[model samples]
Structures are given as C-alpha cells and as structure tokens.
Target: MAKTLKSAAVFLLFFILILLTNYETNNMVVEAALCKKRSATYPWASCVPLVNDNSCETHCKNKEAAVSGFCDTIELRQGFIDITTCYCQFNC
Candidate 1:
C-alpha cells in the first residue's frame, strides 16, 4: 500500500508540472502576436478607400488582444492614394 501511494504522488506531481508548463506556453503566445511576431503597430483594418479614419480604431478595440488601431494611407501612383488600413497595437 505504501508503494502504491508513492507512485500516485509521483504521478500527481508530474501532472501538475505539465499543467504549469502548458499555462506558461499559453501566456507566451498571447504576449506575442498570433504568429509569434511581436509588433506594437499592425495594419488591421478593412482596406477601403472610403473608410473613415477612426473606423479602424473601433475595429481594433473589439479585438481581445488589440489595445488600439489607426488608419493610414498609401500612395500607389501619381494622384492615386489608397486609404483605409487600420494598424492594430497590442498591449504586449
């Protein structure tokens, strides 16, 4: 009976260690970006020329990880400007 109890205790300790490791891994992923790329600024808005500047900000706030978002414009060609790209910023 003592031997059996010892075995059970060892198993319990191993299981707890596994649980703690898993939790750490999960936190690491969340702290980083979804693809393991940690960036304060990210383009994360609906790409549309007519989108409002602050529209992306709202979208970023909706994300569980995103702290904020902004809109930016890019010039593709002469007199051609593309607008409506929201850059999302995470707390991490």
Candidate 2:
C-alpha cells in the first residue's frame, strides 16, 4: 500500500509539470505574434478618403513613408461612401 501511494504521488507531480510547461509555451507564442518585426520590405499604411492613386501615394510620403504608396479602397455603403487607403512598403 505504501509503494502504491508513492507511485501515485509521482504520477501527479509529473502531470502538473507537463501542464505548466504547455501553458508557458503557449503564452510566449501569442506575445511574439503581437509584436511582429520585419527586417525588409515591411509595410505600414495610412487610410483616408481619396480620389486618386497618385494623390494617395503623395499623402503617405508627407507622413514619412519610405516609399510612395498605391490606393486601396474599402466600400462602406455599396456605392455611396468608400474609404481609400495607402500602403507604403519599406525596410524595418
């Protein structure tokens, strides 16, 4: 009976260790994704209501963008309102 109790206690301690290790690993992976870094050709964008691609690129440049950007738009109300954005690509 004493040997059986010792074996059970060992099994419980090993199970707890496995659970704690798995939890720590998952936490690290999530934190890393949120603070992602890019060494080359990283992109940062600014959004605005725009009329033309050249205009958008020029706008991004004024905001310290490394390269002139292109226009990307999102439709809000089918054909009534749209949001135009510029994405500038550059090195990190």
Best by lDDT: 1
Model 1 lDDT tens row, 1-92: 99999999999999999999999999887767564343344453453435435456666787535776666676677687654356776664
State the weakest 10-residue window (summed lDDT) of model 2: 37-46
lDDT of 2 at 7: 98
How many clashing residue pairs are found in candidate 2?
0
What shift in Å separates residue 66 of candidate 1 from its native position after superposition?
A: 16
lDDT of 2 by residue, 1-92 (tens): 99999999999999999999999999888767643431122122334334333454565566545455565677989999976555554433
Clashing pairs in 1: 44-86
Instruction: Find the 10 residues in a row with the least total lDDT in model 1.
Output: 35-44
Q: Can you tell me which runs of candidate 2 are displaced by over 4 Å?
A: 36-72, 84-92
Off by over 4 Å in 1: 34-92
Query: Model 2 — TM-score against the truth?
Result: 0.44
